[model samples]
Target: MVKCNTMPEVRSEIDRIDRELVRLLAERQTYIEQAGAIKGERSAVRDEARIEDVVAKVLAEAERAGLSPAIAEPLWRLLIEKSIEHEFTVFDEKKKKIASA
Candidate 1:
């Protein structure tokens, strides 16, 4: 929604889009939680290649939408890293079970 003309007319629309991103991130986290449950004792919660795939796919969409790919990449990278951390914490179930045995 960035005004390619540098006008403020598109600012509100951009803000709306940003809010949508927040909601989408929340939705994505819910799915990540489910993935953790399904991983079930696997010590590794993240696949780096999968993250790369995500970034690549998102960047492609951004480009197609005429948004700056540069702006999107770092934003998604931070999101992906946070997801990995959240998933990894739950994966300690495997570690704990191994230790207690």
Candidate 2:
């Protein structure tokens, strides 16, 4: 992290971080879509055990990284929820394609 002497510098660094985050998220989304395709059933898309495991791992990493649980926990829960929703959409679309074929 770079030390910023001005508001513009801080905002610039934040903008850079946001762009990087979006790139990483897009990469993650590809894997989520792949999981959707690989899953044998729609029911498998939302795995409760996996969600808890992810949250636990994220919380541990957050603690190691000094990020606040108040921020990390809720942020990850929402991200996971949205990812599941996206995976469902992907799964359904593939099913539709197969059915139509």
Candidate 3:
């Protein structure tokens, strides 16, 4: 990470980071869609145990990466929630297509 000498430099770095974050999120979404397709049932889309496991793993990684739990925990929870919602949508769409075929 470059040390920002001014507010403009800080903003520029933030913008760059935001772009990278979006790209990474898009990649993650692809896997979420694949999961949607692979799961056998709609009830499997939201796994409580898996959600907790993911949160635990992310918290551990955040500790190692020096990211504050305050930020990481809620951020990941929301991200997971949104991903599950997207997965549910994908699952429904696939099921609809299969039924019509």
TM-score of each: 0.71, 0.98, 0.98
Please report the candidate that would top lDDT against the real structure: 3
- Candidate 2 C-alpha lDDT tens digits along 5-89: 9999999999999999999999999999999999989999999999999999999999999999999999999999999999999
lDDT of every predicted structure (CA atoms):
0.81, 0.98, 0.99
Model 3 TM-score relative to the real fold: 0.98
Instruction: Count backbone clashes in candidate 3.
Output: 0
Model 1 has a clash total of: 0
Residues 4-91, candidate 3, lDDT per residue (tens digit)?
8999999999999999999999999999999999999999999999999999999999999999999999999999999999999999
Minimal lDDT window, size 10, model 1 = 1-10
| Candidate 1 per-residue C-alpha lDDT over 1-101 given as tens digits, one digit per residue, 9 for 90 to 100 | 25456546577678788899899888998888778767855655778789899999999999999879889999889988899888776566645776799
Q: Model 1: runs farther than 4 Å from truth?
A: 1-15, 93-101
Q: Model 2: how far is 91 from its true place, Å? A: 0.4
